[model samples]
Target chain A: MEGKVDTRYWRFCLWMGPTFVLVFFLCWGVLGHNFPPFPPDTPASEVAGWFRENHNGVKLGMVIAMTFAPAYGVWGYALAKILGQVIRDEHNIIVQLARLGAAWTTMAILIATSFWLTAAFRPDALPDWMIQLLYDMAWLLIDLAYAVTSVQLFALGIGFLADKREVPLIPKWLAWYGIWVGFMFAAECLMPYFMNGAFARNGILNFWIEFLIWMVWVPYLTICGFKAIGRIEQE
Target chain B: MREAVQADLASANSQSATDDTIPPGDSGVWVFIIADMCAFALFFVLFAAGRIAQPEVYEASRQQLDGAIGLANTLILLTSGAFMAQAVRAARKGNRAATLSGLGLALGVGLLFGITKAFEWSAKLNQGIGLTTNEFFTYYFVFTGIHFLHFVVGIGVLFALIARVRKFDLDTTQQRWIESGGAYWHMVDLLWIVLFAMLYLMRAA
Candidate 1:
């Protein structure tokens, strides 16, 4: 019975990966500004124009994005269950660290949504600088602070290598991929520092390349975790 | 008893042949290592392209770097990598003493690299060089910072390897661990080789 429950939990975890991508795309990709994100120096007047152009839709997008933000916590819960089987010892601090990372990221996403909503809430009466402030904060939260996600992945990667289960949960190499991606996300810290170059928020390396890599990583983790669950249940 | 000994000998012979054909370490670590190299390759390309686009900026920045320190660090990493390779070899032969000594040499050299890097960074900081100093400094700091992080992680892995080696004999898992450690150390060495040439040695565009 306990095993059955675990299987169910992981299935939900797998599902959330795509759910995140969908909600993320609907807001940040489909509804949000351009892919690397709009430049930092984008004037408030331009943002006001966008808000005027897409008012209700922008608000609705932020609401939807905020609603889906808690999916991070569920993902973390399921991940902890899976990783716990391997690092079931008292010294498993990384597992706790991973949970903290997940919580921090979720809070961050919530704050980011608030920033986006503020930009769209009032444009005509508010000063251009105020709207621009909201815009800058939102994008910076997403791109500049990618280190939070990096920590989450790094913890998971460590879990994979440290897991001594007789039937390992995931392949150890996949763990390396997790660690690699986590490290790469650190590139985004340079995003706000570059307004015009490839490292800029809207630039190729920081925005386009890094975001695409993360998209691929989401599905990879989901499929691999799903397979590992199957293997564990069969055992 | 005689038949059991013969069976053992047969398996031992087969094991060596397998070792010759298969790559070192777990297939898992190799997968990660290869992908990591690909990422570095992209960085190299981007850095080169950036240099080409802003030749004067890159050239001026390149002149400010200390090539001698870079060269020394390269040799240090190379020597440490060599020691790691020797450690793996000794572990395979079940020579505990040799393995420990090799690991120690590698660890010491690896630590030296860290110290030298800290000095180099502080010197640059004293000179008012920073991540946002210019395009060249930005790339230089970010690139080297990321690599330095990897080096720190690598040192931890080395320490773990040393502990494991001292605590246990070269069982199958231990053998795999040795391979994985060697693979990781070599990666650190390999990344530096290219970074040195590009950041410290290559002629300005």
Candidate 2:
């Protein structure tokens, strides 16, 4: 029995890719005050002071971030399904791996945000050291968990590179860029080793360059995903 | 089969003549190389900023580094890059023997670079200097460590090129593969030169 495929729903899923990007940047980045994240070497009292002043904003940001965390998974699913179509192998392991990576990435984001939320939940009652510890723990968990997102990009890149079409669904340069971005995430591994320098969680190399590259990659891939869906529908 | 091989050689030469406008290697590989360079540039900027912030610490750390070893690794990578260039050129000419020899020499020299780097890192580690020793050593270990990763990947690419060239004729696509791998190997060399200069030779003040 042939069942009808809903191309409209697929398009909506692809649209979620950008929606996730916008919401994530606003809530987790700007409102959460993670745009210029607290330095790893920040004193416990300072950490507590900042949280005390911005607890409500932090709480709201983390709540919205956690609620919409699954948007990333939905976006990944849509991208992977389109990738399966491009490779003409619906059961390809790389596609599933990409999907799994996105799911785990969502979990990482969710858990990290929850830690921040809990830190904000009782900033007045908790010790300054406790708040600082929670903050540090959240950053470490999110930064070091970069490999999960790397796996997703690598799988997607490999999948796109394997497409034999003369005009591939995803651009070849974008695929290479994705792989390069994934490789750059290796810098995050050095985050735990340094407290203030370039390799630190808040340093230029680890935080600004790494996250900016990832942010650029998401929109690039989302645009490509939208185009790929349109092309697949036409075919 | 021999005629087919000869045909491929002629095609490669003709393609080579017309493809001058195209940059060496696969454009996709170039994309990766360019992005990787941008990342390393950011690393260098940050290192420079840190050095400026603590010039005395950086200068002291620079003195502690073995400059002779850094210079020697620079030469090794230069030599490896030359061999890689030779390999790509030979592949274009469909000279299988020279291609293999060039690749083999490049891979060997690349391995020597790795060995030298391992010894340098171990020596430092044995001296109780490591990534977290200070801002200077932090930059040192992190920069060199990441460059070491690129070198390792370049070695793997060279090995893969050798295996591919061994089994298949140097068709146009295989030639492109060689060029791409050679491009990446050269990039590794280029990055190390900058790293060597920034870390070992430059006066922090």
Candidate 3:
């Protein structure tokens, strides 16, 4: 029989779930206020009104904490810890650190490339301030994913090659799958910028293709991360 | 062996085929972040369309936001993110006291951030600006409000982690908890930095 699931993890989930529901409800509730509340209608005037009317409230803090804490905070840390354990024997801790460093370095380069490319053709399409904002947000996503994935993959690859050990933290197939999926994402990110006019010249494929890929890959990565996290003890 | 590998790959492929609930990469703790981003995307899209429709109101409203508080919050969140990161590293090294201390520092910084935000929101509300006032307040309410909720949850998670971390195996659970927590905290911080520009600084320009 399966043992009892970890309650602390459940508590983390419980705390996270309701707050998520509330955010969605608040967003979709068809509530009033002219700041162009719906997606298609949003504009600078509406957003400015949003800025002008902005007030500090308990709800804001509550939402921020609920949305951010477990997802990136708890889950990300857990992912790191799993990495530390998975490679406990074959490689020293320094190797893990090196993997993390390399991952982040690569991510930074990719982000810089995306920013420079996006800004090159447009000139002032995105203002200096806006450019910086997008740059930071985009990089955060890149770095976080890169750091976590790098360590995990390094561990799996090394373990696979070294002792033929069953990579306890992540299933061998799942780990390989993650690397493949990650590589696809990298290719997708690089393709439009590198391939030039030959493919996706219309730019129509850029948006929809990404949508399709995310539709397939996002869940796969999430499941893999969670399964790996949950298996930490077993490892 | 080949057949087993093929079967595993098949299962993985089939698993990602569905488009219902949350996406696969957004399970467990990340469920909230994914949902939060979607909600924010909706808000952003709304903002974009609204700007297209009524450039005047959006621009005027932009002139009124407090850039100072936005900057302050950015700094606070960034600082808390640093603490959280430190906590994760400390925990991974099996330094229980350091883990607790680091988490405590993060929690304290987070609370300070909430307090400042609360004061900021209350002051704005007192000034007669709120969600019901216009589209701007609506987003102000929705976006900042959502961000605030995330802040609170981050604190709670820190507390929970602090409480139970002592008992768990340092190698497996403790460090991951801290790392994920820090990453989420950093996202919040990062979002605020964006908001600072879009809502506040962008207006000045």
| Top lDDT prediction, candidate number | 2
Instruction: Give a tens-digit lDDT track for model 1, residues A196-225.
Output: 777888777787778887788777877877
Would you estimate the TM-scores of all the predictions? Answer: 0.88, 0.93, 0.43
Q: Is the docking of candidate 3 incorrect, acceptable, medium or high quality?
A: incorrect
User: What tens-digit string does per-residue lDDT give for candidate 3 at B141-200?
Assistant: 656776776677678878888887766766544455566566667767877776677677
When summed lDDT is taken over every stretch of 10 residues in candidate 2 chain A, the lowest stretch is A1-10
List model 2 lDDT by residue over A76-176, tens digit each: 99888988887887799999998998999999999999999999997999999999999889999999999999999999999998888889999989999
**Candidates' C-alpha lDDT:** 0.80, 0.88, 0.50
Which tens-of-lDDT digit does each residue in B13-122 have in candidate 2?
Answer: 64543455887677888899999998889888878888888889999999999999999999999999999888888888889999999999999988999899999999
Instruction: Return the candidate ranking by TM-score, descending.
Output: 2, 1, 3
lDDT (Cα, tens digit) per residue for candidate 1, span B34-80: 87787778778779788878889988998999999999999999999
How closely does chain A match the true chain A in each prediction, as TM-score?
Answer: 0.90, 0.96, 0.40
Candidate 3, after superposition: displacement of residue A202 in Å? 32
As a whole number from 0 to 100, the lDDT of residue B139 in candidate 1 is 78
Q: On residues A1-235, what C-alpha lDDT tens digit does candidate 3 reach at each position?
A: 2443332463343233234334423421212121112122235344333323431222243234333323323333333344444554325663454345434533443443343234333433444445334333433343234444444444433432222344444454444433333333332232222222111211222233323433343344345546655664453
Q: What DockQ does predicted model 2 obtain?
A: 0.73
Q: In candidate 1, which residue ranges exceed 4 Å CA deviation?
A: A1-6, A85-97, A163-167, B1-21
